[model samples]
Target: MLEEKFERLRNFLLAYFNQDMESPEGALQEYIEENSEGAISTTLAQINTFLHEDLTEQVKEQFIEDNCDLYFPALELTPVEWLKQVQAELKSTLG
Candidate 1:
């Protein structure tokens, strides 16, 4: 259940916009846990890694564009499409 709710979304959403999360990953997870009807799909262990990484200072958009390979597999869709997905997910979850 967590996997369905958190794992894929976590990878996508966290990596979706940027390696550097707008907030610490744990806080973001907790926000998801409290805010969305879906679920917190990531592990605190991984969030811990995010918290400690250099990504903490990276810009959300820059991180996404630069690491396109990490976030977008095969680069099938254009970056704009990927960004739309990113925006949609964030709006759905965080709005």
Candidate 2:
């Protein structure tokens, strides 16, 4: 499930975000580990929570500040395009 998502995610990050794989992944993992004090809205809380300590004030503030047009990725392709890739690969196997 996740490997299929990497190209989409990487393209999104590269196009609009200041982050690369490690920085964004670290941020997300930190979000996952950090325990919240308040009743976190589910929408906000689902990003990540893997922090091991109280996050610094600045770091906590920037955790999920992902800047991307993730709703419509620039590298986005239609399902038909993906299917065509599969078809091309299968043609090699059948050769």
Candidate 3:
């Protein structure tokens, strides 16, 4: 199921980029707009599960620090909070 989800996302992105040659930032924005619910849900589920499992603390911290701005603009929120926000946004988008 996860593989299928990623395949769908990959196809969407390829088609998106093919239609309009956009900058990396523009592609990201378009990706979110085009696949908002799937993107958010898949990312949230993967990150949430990864965080919950036993992993290198350093790596996890580095990832959160690197992606916090991209995924969660609000710097004040914790990582878990960010995941919850993503999930909420996905639900709202799908609804």
Can you give the TM-score per candidate against the true fold? 0.29, 0.22, 0.40
Give the range of the ten consecutive residues with the poorest summed lDDT in model 3: 66-75
Give me the candidate number with maximum lDDT: 3
**lDDT (Cα, tens digit) per residue for candidate 2, span 1-95:** 22232333333334433434344334434433452323123312222221222556344223313333222233253322322332343333334
Which pairs in model 1 have colliding backbones?
Answer: 6-41
- Per-residue lDDT of 13-85 in model 3, one digit per residue for the tens? 3454343544434654565686657565675566456556565666555544443233334346564454455
Model 3 regions more than 4 Å off:
1-31, 36-40, 56-59, 68-74
lDDT by residue (69-90, candidate 1, tens digit) is 3334454655445545434444
Of candidate 2, the 10-residue stretch with the lowest lDDT total is 43-52
